[model samples]
Target: MNDPYDNCMAACDACAHAYDACTAAYLAERDAQALADCIALDIECAQLCRFASGAMARRSVLTPSVCALCAQACDLCAAECQRHAHDHCRRCALACEACAAMCRAVA
Candidate 1:
């Protein structure tokens, strides 16, 4: 009942929110400096996810290319988040992994 693009868009939107939340949580950590890469990747992944979702929503011709990039961002973010041991990081990693899978399929 759902289109692949629609599903991918939804996943991307969710992952963006997750990444944003993780970034905020990490910023409040005592060793935030150690999470610099994770935070950076979170921001990058969120931005890409938002862009990919927008492109898919409008059925843009470049959706596939955007999705491919989004997938890479999501994967890198997931890997970074997985290096941490916080609940927020775990949640974000899961979301990123799911979004990456969807992006790969959509691409």
Candidate 2:
């Protein structure tokens, strides 16, 4: 059966992937030290999105709570990413925004 939160799950998954890529790219940059906060938040947001996606997929009772947290994490991640001018950060920010919106819809 198709889960009601499938779309949100997909969005979360995409956001996780984007965050992962952005973090990796940032780590390789010359100013990696300056982006420490952004990298940390990206990793955290990715993990939260993954967890929320799993909870939603399983139709867990905690889905709402998890989704709400995921939205907040995604929002923060997006803001952090937006502070940088890198293409990867910009892309990740966009993905995070979309994921946050989807999570909010079901939160």
Candidate 3:
């Protein structure tokens, strides 16, 4: 059977990928300067998600704390992404929302 953390880990992975893609897309936009905060949050969220996923995979004692921080990062990233109307941003927001919920559930 799959571990309980599997779903959350997968969600984190998805969120990280989405954030990376969204960040890259924002950098390519004409108003890249306008997305500075969004880009920075995306980077932070992605890194946190990666670390949380690894912690969960390893069944580390710090998984819960890591997940708590990951959830916060995802929430902030989602809010930032939601401020933009771009397709990539919208998709990233959705992923971040899902990931945040999953992280909260495990945390």
Best by lDDT: 3
Off by over 4 Å in 3: none
Can you give the lDDT of residue 86 in candidate 3?
A: 90
For residues 5-76, write the lDDT of model 1, one tens digit per residue: 988888999999999899999899899898787888888889999999999988999999999999998888
Candidate 2 per-residue lDDT, tens place, 14-103, comes to 999999999899899898998898889989999999999999888899999999999999999888888888899899999999999999
Name every residue pair that clashes in candidate 2. Answer: none
Ranking by TM-score: 3, 2, 1
C-alpha positional error of residue 6 in candidate 3 after TM-score superposition, expressed in Å: 0.4
Clashing residue pairs in candidate 1 are none
Give the clash count for each candidate. Answer: 0, 0, 0
**TM per candidate:** 0.94, 0.95, 0.97
* Local distance difference test scores for all models: 0.91, 0.93, 0.94
Q: Give the higher-TM-score candidate: 1 or 2.
A: 2
lDDT of 1: 0.91
Poorest stretch of ten by lDDT in candidate 1: 76-85
